[model samples]
Structure formats: structure tokens, C-alpha cells
Target: MRASLTPTDAPLRARLLALALAVAVLAAVAVVATVRAADRAAEKDRAQPGEPAAHAGEVTLRQPGRLLFRNLAWGPQRDRVSAVPLTATSGPRTSAPRDCLRFHAAAGTGVCLRATGGVVPGHEAVLLDARLRPVRAFPVPGTPTRARVSPSGRLVAWTVFVSGDSYAGGAFSTRTAVYDTRGGTLHSDLERFAVLKDGRRHRAADHNFWGVTFAADDSRFYATLATGGRTYLVAGDLASRTMRTLRENVECPSLSPDGTRVAFKKRVAGASADAPWRLHVLDLRTGRESALAERRSVDDQALWLDDRTLLYALPGDFGADLWSTPTAGGGAPRMAVRSAASPAVTG
Candidate 1:
């Protein structure tokens, strides 16, 4: 015979029963949520309907009239350096076997920044030849944010965020390196370069530099210098190992092909806290500035598709899609390449 519990003990027993039932219900819901998440993750590995066709093949950065970018499509070829028609980016593409987080190429030379996996994850920068074959690899201390090569393809530069992987909390530190492919000279940290802020010697422990854009001369370059809550467009000399501040609020400066202006991200007033940058161009000779027609906040470095058109990446359905806008600031922004990032024009 089952024994009947006392009044107080019966009430405690009821509470215990209710607690167990609630726990079981919560566990069931959690299991369903986890299963749904796993299914969604699995779906990303399969090619969805209406997606662009991509195949693993030889990708050469030496091919002119091709646009090279980090593929963000969902499939086996995802995250590889892919090549597509410069004008018709919506068409099919050829993906290379090499994977990179950021990539840039010029004059048949490519710099691929990739993540390394082990017990401890890390990153590295790989120099690639015209055939997209790695020539050498350099260990990077942190997450790669930018990679660039000189027009002559003799110099390669990269930037890594040292403190954290992103600018999520408005505080981060970066390390920029420049490698001379021809001379085998490497300046692993640009902070060691002498600073000439305001035409006088400037010394600060808080200084940081990134987003290097080389001049056609290959001896001169421009990059962003940050210190004391302000950012500057600093012109640098590789021969002299010095940098001089030019203007303010310029970040990720990409020099124009003509060497007359720079396309950069400017933090403007009346912008949302999270999305705080607008694409702008600064005339290197005249110091005149003009904002582009891209009203959306662009976080990536702007690349000059030509003298008048600018290309950049924005958040998209797959990962990021490249968009184009007129540099003179008139028409609406147009999507240039879908599911691609880190655009580099091959020549």
C-alpha cells in the first residue's frame, strides 16, 4: 500500500514535482533549438538554388581583366581566392585551392593573409606568384585585417589587429608590416618608422599605422596614423623610413591609380554609433575632399576599379558583397560582385 504524506510534506512534494516538470519542458525546447541550429549549419554547406556557379580550378592573378576576391559563397570553394570577369562579376568564377581571410594582388604578385589552425589558432601572410602559388609565408601575431601589394609588385604590406580581432568596442591595436619582395627587406612593424607629425618630431607610445597604399614610384606610400583620439593621412617614405601627417580623419587610404587622390573612410558627424564611416576621397595635391554617393557605412578598404569608380564590400546574405559607386559622388551605389570581399584588380 502506498503511504499518504502529511499536509506539509505533501505541499513540498507538489513543489518538487512542478520543478521537475518545468525542467523537462525546458530541456525539450533546448533540444529542438539545438537541432534546428545544426540543420541550418548543414544547409550552409550545400549549394542553394540560384547561387552563382563556382568550380575549383587554377586561379592566376596575372590574368588581366579579371577581378580577384575572397570567395564567400556557401560550398567547398568558399573562402578561397576566386577570379571572375572584371565587368561581369555575376557570372561563374574559378576558385583556387588556397584559402585566405584577406587577399590583394598587383602586377601578378599576390599577398594572401590566412588563418592557421592547431591547438592554438593563429594567422600568417603568404606571398603568391602569378600562378597563385605560395612563394613564402610569414607568421602574423594576430588577425589579419588588410593586405596590399605595390603596383610594381615588388612590395607587399599587411595589417593585423593585435589587441582584438575587430573594432567592435571602439578600442583596438594594429600591427602593419611591409615586405620588399625584390630586396628581401622587411619592416615587420611600421611603428619603428620615424614620425614627423605637424612637421616636428612626434613621439607617442599610442601611435598605430595601417592601410598602406603605395605610390606608383614604389618608394613612397600613404597610410593611416592614429594617436591621441585622432587619425591622420600620413605620407611615408620607404627609403627614408619616415612618415609625415597630411590631413585628418582618413582611415584605410587607397591611393588612386593616377597618384593624385586617395579613397578612404571618413568618420562624419550625424552617423550612427555603430556605422560611423562614409566613403570619401582626398585630393593629395590640393587637399580637397569629396564624399562618394555610397550612403551606407562602408567598413572595408575602398579599391579603385578605375579612375572614377570605387569598389567596396558590405554585409550581405552569404557573407559580404562588393559594391561600386562613382568617385565624383552622384549616382546610387550598385552591387558589383555578390558573395565576394577583398577585391583586387588583376593586371
Candidate 2:
């Protein structure tokens, strides 16, 4: 019952229908392409193993100094420092191992504690220049555990585990030492420093000092002093060669960037043997402590992300992953990076 169309009208209608279908096909392809691109981006965010996400272009240090830490995947005997660019979040660059067991860097200088294996079994500290080249090396004692350089890169410190001071089935005793890079001097052990507890000297041979964190002045420091089956946080004066206890149950203290607070690991009694420590922050001026949101046992010293955030390593099956939390406390912990340990960021 429809009227017949003219020949020209029929041909024009056919062409219009073809054009509409082509446009629909192109639209569908675009949608599919967008979805695939999003999938690739998500995958890149989670870097795999030693591979960091590829950068878009040349990466440079926007903050002038890069982060430096120990690469746990490098193995104990062959561990090296992982230099992470401040401007670039991914794709860290690796430097020579140089027999470093643990390392930390600040300012323009770096410090590496190397462990020697053989019949003697000793440890040593190696100093590095701004270019990460070894400038000087010296022998140290005990098993290497921690190393730190001052903010100015003029002072260095280390902690070593030695036997004969640990309780039965207890953690080994620690020996902490500091060196003056400019003066060519070394304070072999801090245990000899006068220990004052509650305004009185604590005379005990079991006294062990470890995990030394330096102040900006380089002449003042803080460390964990463990004695009499208890641990205390002690503020030390380098020139006076004395340590005064600040508080109890605090260990592995790391000062915040602004020097207002100290992020530390608190040993909690009655917790599981596997996870007995909790992360806490202490206000240096007020002596107030704020418990972080992280409740799991954190053993490593925390690295401050800024004046308000902290970075730490939580032990995992394949090394440890980097995590961050707010310095004010009561915020859920978030993963900042993966497969890293002993984090040190340059100022």
C-alpha cells in the first residue's frame, strides 16, 4: 500500500544507511580501546619484582636529593643501596653493592655498613661521597644491623649485634658506635657513656645501646638503651658523653623532619611472640605519645614521609613492602611502595 520511491531517492537512502552503520562501528571500537588502555594503566601501577613502572620521559630529582635504602632482594652478602628519585615515584636506580649489608644516606653523603664473612666474621663501615663513590672505609665489630648518617653528612652511626648479653632465647645485645667524618674520629661503643635513669646513674653491665638517631646539630643524639630486662629511650650529648633516659618501652627512634616528634616502635607486653611491637610517635617537647593506627608488630625503624606522614616496612614472604601512615595517628595504613626495606629519604 506504500507509494513507490523515485530511483534517485532510493539510491540516496541506501548511501545514508551505510554511513550510519560505519559511524556506529567506529564508536564501538573507541569504547573498546578506552577500556583496554585503562586495564594497562592499572597493571602498571603495581610494579613487579625489581621492575618499576616505565617513566614517560627523563626523570630528575625535583627535591635536589634522592631517597636511599637497602635493597633486600640483593641478598645479605651482596645487598646494595636503592636510590629512588624524589620527583619520580617509580623505577628506582641501583648502585654498586660494595659488600654493604645495610645503608642510609642524607644530605649529599652516604654510609654503608659491610659485613665480612669467613673464619674471622667481622663488620666494617664505608663512607661514600655525593656521587655514591667510596671515599673511606674502616673496620667495625659485631654483626651489622643499622647505619645512619647525620643530616649534614658529617656524622655517622651504626648498631651491631654481639653475643653474651642476651637472655636465654632472647634477642642479642647491641653495640652502637658513632664516627666523625671530618675529624677522623670514632666512638667505638656508646655503652661506656654515662646512663642516667630517673636522675640517677644506671650502673649495669647488661646496658646495651643501639638504634642511634642524630639531631641536626650532629652533637646531640637519641638511642634505645636496654638494661635490667627493660628498654628505655635516652637522649645523649656527644660532647658530654652522657645519655639521660627519656621514657620506657621505646626503641628504634626516628626523628621527624621538623624535629618536633619521634616515630618509634613500642614493645608491647603480653602480645604474641611473633608480633610484639607497635608503632608509636612521641612528641619530643611535650613527652606525649600517640599510637599509630598500625597495630601489627613493626620491627624496622620508621621513615618520615613529611612532617605529617611516616613510611615503614612490614615483613612479607618475599622481603618487605613499604607502608605509610599519618603522623597524627588513627588512620589506616596504606602501601606506598613494594619490596623495599630500611627506607631513608633525603631532605
Candidate 3:
């Protein structure tokens, strides 16, 4: 036996139901808002013009145990990213795009800085597999100049010449970006980092960075920071988002396998960009800079063949030839590979 609801009770029950409906609607709207915000953020991070959007969520890279080397000289006629056996005298070229101006390979992964050189120019950073297939592509702002992948293939960094006038004594500006392959995060233009000059905040609009070389731990990196008409070698902390100037006039720094020294191009007092840059090795712990014996102006970021030797590229009639010298200083430069501008050593 249940008593029927009074008229007042009916009104109260109806009001309660309406209140629940309103609360449900608000909750649904909030969920939708959250999802939309996430989508917008991902869209903002992605670069355009590649077949697949640069941000495709997390994709695991398959790496080989023994990775090969790829320089401009090694790739196939169509594609300049062909993997060449380091020990082989010669190898078959692949059909990958030879448009890669600079490239680096490590940990079964690689990155190629491709350029369409013409009256109307365009650039891209193309991620590649060990077989030299494009895994993903991201549009770059300027002429591709440098590319490097961390030893573990967890990070990739690149630089491009963004702006310059021929009348300005060939002076140029660069933009660099570091991408975390695993995290799917890209830090564009390292100039955003809090820069410290002599342990003080340094601010400038013309700050530029290039030639990033990552440490084995992948937490610390070194690169060239140009600002105020001067260039410096900056040691950067990726986690802290900060950089400290280490030395002056150090450009295109490449870390040694031992991580104790860096091979970099030093600007000579009387020399111009047209001539060879004197290459030097700086002991990170000792602050000792030793000049390499290679007299040829080395324009490319030097690569370490082993702890004992260093490799760099010199402009040649054929194109650019890869040359090697001793890291201990005072060794004649020898041709390691011909027609190659960029060299990457795989661990």
C-alpha cells in the first residue's frame, strides 16, 4: 500500500529531475571542451607540407644493431640517403631523393635536410628509416644546413639558414629546432632558451643557434649561438631549457665519442667564409683548444671517426669531399669518401 504523491510533491520531483538533466549537460560540455583544446594544441605543434602531418602521435622507430653510414657521397643517384657500408670500397646507390643538402644517421634512424634550390626555395626535415624511407616530414623555414640524430635515436636536431643579404658580407641568420621523437615534442628555435652570458641573463632579438651536438645521455647538448655580432659555443640543458656560453668563436660543434672533447670550426682572424675555417678540438673539462692539422678550410661540422680521428668535408670540383684528420693534432688530411658533404657515424 503506497500513498499517491500530493500535488506539491509532484512539483518537487519534477524539479529534481530537471536539475539532474542540467548537471549532465554541463558535464558533457566540459568533456567536449577539453577534447577540442587538446586537438588545437596538437595542430599548433605540427609543421605542414609533408604528405603525413608532422605530428602523428607516438611512433616507435625500429633500429638495427649495427647501423651504417650515409653521407652525400653514399646515397643513390635519385636519393642521396643511401646507406653505405663504412668498410666497403663502393656500393650501389639507392633511388632516394638526392635533394638532401645535409644528413645524419644513428641508432638505426636518420634525418635528411632536403632543399628545393631555385628562384623559389623550400626546405624540409625528412625522418628516415635505416633503409632510407621517409617516415615523416616537417617543413623547414630556410636552407637546410645541419642535421643530427642522437645515438639512441630518441632526439633529432637541425638548422637552416633563415635570412641573409648578399650585400651584407655574406652574413646569414639561422634557426634551429630539436625534436623529441619519443615524446612527440618539438622545441623550435633554441633562442627561446634562457641564455646566460657570463652567468647573467642575455637578451637579444637577433639570437640564433646552429649545429647542435647531443651528449650520449641525451640530456645535454652543445651548439653555436650567434648574437651581438659574435658567436659562442653554448652548453645547453634540455631539461632546464637554458644555455651557458662556454667559449668564443666556436661554430659547428661535434661531440666526440668519449664526450670529453668537441670538434668545431674556428673563425680565422684574416680569413673569410669563402676560405677554409680552421678546425679545433676543445677539451671540455680542461678548456684546452688544439688545432687540427687540416689546412683546408673546413665548412662542414666535423665528425668523429673514432676517438683518434676526425672527419670533415671540403669543397671540391666534383662537389664536397669528405676528409679525415687526427684529433691529436698534426696529421695530413686524407680523403675518406668523395662527393660527400655531410658525414654521420653510427654506433
Candidate 4:
């Protein structure tokens, strides 16, 4: 009872339906192609080593392998030390290859020595050298906590922590020891300056002393003392055997390469371990203090490329990365290297 459509009208209706279906098909195909391209790009990014993105400003470290070095001002090019095996484990489970000793053109050459013999809780430490090989291996005593060489390459200092049981109860103490490479002897003058909590002279291995570093001339050194329910930075006179408090409530102090400043990390009150700490710089000459940079997470291992440039390790998802910032306070942090920690700037 309905009239039939003409042939021309019928063709037009069919063409419109066909076009709509074609458009829908094309859209689906485009979406699939886009998803595949994205997946490929992600794979490529992962395959690449180091940081996925490059940082602009300062210098770029694109060197391969486990090590990377970028010259900030240029003094002496770093001397590449031969890769030495550190572990006794055999087969495929062996420890990863690490630099036992490294020498910066500015910091001089040093041989990294592993603990040997009947040393309790053996640990590793580095001994500075004026030439290629070390003059002598410095004794770190107890368990080695931290080690560093003087800027002038005259002295090496480290922290040792000993834990044992006492008559009263369980006890623990930290000691700071320094070795004179030229003299080939360990100095005990500062070790005796440490005192017990009861105002008594500390005997061998009594109190805890950490974060030891020597000045340029090796005549003076600084270390952190945690005792009497407080932490303090103490500067020791090697010649006079006198100890003076430099700062309080600070830990992990790193002396600047020029020996004019000290950088340290501090914890804030009412803050948890998840909260970040502040990095502070103290002027040795004027006793003035200033905050160098504020980080969102914990930061340690600070080293000076020069008097004005500072380098430190930042925590990352996989590991730590090296970042550099200006000590004068300008510009954001730029990536110096990736997947490395304990950055000791050479040259």
C-alpha cells in the first residue's frame, strides 16, 4: 500500500549509509594505530640508558657505563683508575664491579683499601696518595661509617662505631681516626679528646664520633659527635690537640674543596623520616650559616666541584642520581649524572 521509491532516490539513500559506516571504521583504525605507536615509544624510552630526558643548563653528562664525569670549571682531567675486584664471591653471584679507589685532579689520587685480618666487622676505607699508589693504608678501627681525603691530599679521616655489652648494659660508641700519609702514622691526639657522658675522659673507643674531614693544610679537621643526647660538629686542631664546637644539631658535614665552607644535612623538628631534610652551608672563616638548597627527600654525600658549585646525590625510584646546584643561589638543579651516588668530583 506504500508507493515504491524511484531508482535515483534509492541510490542516494544507500550512498549515505555507506559513508557513515566507512567513517566509523576509519576512526577505529586510527585509534588502534595511535595505541600501537605509544607502546613502541615507551619501549624505546626504557631501552635507553641514563635519564630519559636531557637537562639544559650547566653541563650534560652523557657518558656511558657505570660512571660519568662532567667538568664544571676544568682543573685537571680525572685519572681513570683500573677496575679492581672487591668481593671474594665466585661465579655469577659475584658483586658488581666498583671503583675501589679514584683520584680527582683536584683531590689527588688515592687507593681504596679493603679491610683485612682479624678486624671486627670489617669495612672499607680510602687512603690518599700524592702520586699513583698509596703511601700506606690508614686504619679505620671499628666499623667504617664514613671516609674522605683532604683537599690538599695530606690526610685521610674516617668514622668507626663499636657496639658491645658493658657492666651496666649494652653500649655503643663512635670514634674518629685520622692518618698522616706523609708521616705514615695514625694520630691519637683527637681520639683522646672525646669525653664520656659523665664528664670523664673517654678511653680508647668510648664515645661516638662521625663525619670526619681534614682542612686543606691537614692542620685542622672536623667531625660530628653524637653524645649527651645532642649532636655537634667539632673542629680539632691537629697541631694543638684542642677541640672546639663548630655547630650543634647537625650531622654528616662535608668540607668544601677550598676548605672555606662546610656543608651538612639537618633534620627538622616534628618531621618523620619520610619528610625531607635541609642542606646547610657554614662559612668557616666568619662562622656564618646559610641554607644551600631545600630538597623534598633525604640528601647526603655532598661534594664541591669548586668554591661556587655544589654537587650532591638525590634519591630516585631506581637508585640515586647526581645533581649540581650553584652555591651562590640561582637556577634550578640540573642533572649531572644518573644512577650514581657518593659523587666525588674529580678535576
Separately for all candidates shown, the number of backbone clashes (residues 3 or more apart, or on different chains) is: 0, 0, 6, 3
lDDT of 4 at 316: 55
The 0-to-1 C-alpha lDDT of every candidate, in the order given, reads 0.91, 0.76, 0.75, 0.54
Candidate 3 accuracy as lDDT: 0.75
Q: Write the per-residue lDDT of candidate 2 for residues 1-347, one digit (tens) a residue.
A: 99889989988999999999999999999999999998766654454555432222222112365665555443332245665675654565554434367777777677778876799877788888766678888787677777888878889998877764322225677778899988988898998889888999879978888888889998998888888777788999989999999999888899877777889998777887666788999998998999999988887778887888888888754477778899898779987655566767866
**TM-score for each model:** 0.88, 0.77, 0.75, 0.60
Q: Candidate 1: minimum summed lDDT over ten consecutive residues — where?
A: 163-172
Give the candidate number with the greatest lDDT: 1
Q: Candidate 2 local accuracy as lDDT?
A: 0.76
- For candidate 1, lDDT tens digit of each residue in 115-167? 99899989999999999899999999888999899999999999999986554
Worst 10 residues of 2 by lDDT: 53-62
Q: For residues 90-144, could you state the per-residue lDDT of candidate 3 as single tens digits?
A: 4432224434777887776788888655898788998887656788888899887
The residue-level lDDT of candidate 1 at 162 comes to: 94
Q: How big is the positional error of residue 321 in model 3, measured in Å on the Cα after superposition?
A: 0.7
Model 4 spans > 4 angstroms off: 1-98, 101-107, 111-121, 126-135, 138-143, 161-173, 188-190, 194-206, 274-276, 297-299
Winning candidate number (TM-score): 1
Supply the TM-score for candidate 3: 0.75
Better of 3 and 4 by TM-score: 3
